[model samples]
Every structure is written in C-alpha cells, then in structure tokens.
Target: MVMLGDILAAARGSAGALERWLAHADPQLAQDTACAAKSVGLGIAGYARMAVADFSRFANEEDWATLVSSLRDSSDPGSTCLAAMVHWRLSAVGCRAHSIPQEAGAKDE
Candidate 1:
C-alpha cells in the first residue's frame, strides 16, 4: 500500500492533486502539513510542514504507472454479496497462485 501511495503521488505531480485534495481536507489536518517547500533539517522542524505533491518524485512516471497497474490487476476481485467470480477464476487449475506448487515454494525470485 505504501508503494501504491508513492505511485499515486508521482502520477499526481507536485501541484495538481495535492491542492485539490487539500481543498476538501479538515482545516486542522490541512494546516498541520501545510508547507509548500521542501525541508531537510534536523528534528521535528523537518516535518513541521509538508505537502502531498512532494511525494513519488522518486520513480520515473512511465515505469511507476506500469508497476501500479500490474499490482492492481494481480488482485482478483469480488463483491461479498454477489456470486463469486474473479476469485474462482484465479483459483482455476492453471491460473495465478495455482500455476505452481506453493507447498514447496521457490525462493530467490
């Protein structure tokens, strides 16, 4: 989930989504991380003010999008109240976690 957040941050850029997200935030919560600048000092001062847009700059945009997409697709989906579908499809004889013998799992992927 942390990675997912990071990927989302990168896709959102330094101003677009952060400003929009802040617009709907509780006033105190928004004020708490209110800084628009980057800080790299010691102690609590470093985090006294922060912004959401500053994150996920660590990864290349294209690669990040692909990675996030892959992770999202890997999870099979279903609504608990409905007839099961994706979960059963993934558990089919030749798919996903069933593709290999998990009992004797391979290491060093």
Candidate 2:
C-alpha cells in the first residue's frame, strides 16, 4: 500500500524540481508541454500563484485540472515550465495511485 507520507515526499521533491526548473526554464520545453496539454483539451488560464501544498493532492482528476489551469495559464515561461513539471509529477502519481485516467492529457510529451 502506498503511504500518504510517501506521496507527500514525492510531491515535495516535485516542488523542489519546480524551483530548479524555474531558475532555468526552457522556452521550447515549456511550449511543448503547453501544446501537449492543449492538444488533449486542457484549458490554459493566466498566471496565478499556485499554493505549494497543492502538489500534495494529486489524488483525482479535478486536482490535476486545477494545477493545469493555474500553471499553464501563465504568460511567464517559468510558470509554464513549472506547470509542465507539475503535470509530469501529477501524472506519475496518478498512475501509481490509479486515481486519474491516462486519457486526461497525462502524457508529458
């Protein structure tokens, strides 16, 4: 059984990765990630600060959507990259937890 603590630890790791990615975000990668999400019908909103704790709740499709909406909507490249990273982590968590479907734009590339 997957422990909540393990999931949270992974989420925290993802957050750390986000910080690193933000420091040197690649425009091409960000653009590709956004396109991948859009191709799967996820709406991109505008930039808004995502709570650090949100990373710990990838237990459902709704949670995934919330993250995508907040992160992908950003006009800033760093935020876009962060969205991509968050999506990657959430997708992995969803697969491991079997909470989210594979068809929900979970593919990062």
For candidate 1, lDDT tens digit of each residue in 1-109? 2233442354345444443443353343334333211222211112211211122332346544644465556542111101111122212234343232223344434
lDDT by residue (tens digit), candidate 2, 13-97:
5644433443355545445444543554442221112222334444357665765676556665345534454455434543334
The residue ranges of model 1 lying beyond 4 angstroms of the native Cα positions read 1-7, 10-14, 35-109
Please, what is the whole-model Cα lDDT of each candidate in the order they appear?
A: 0.30, 0.42
The parts of candidate 2 lying over 4 Å away from their true place are 1-24, 46-54, 59-87, 90-93, 96-109
lDDT of 2: 0.42
TM-scores for all candidates: the values are 0.24, 0.28
Mind sharing the TM-score for model 2?
A: 0.28
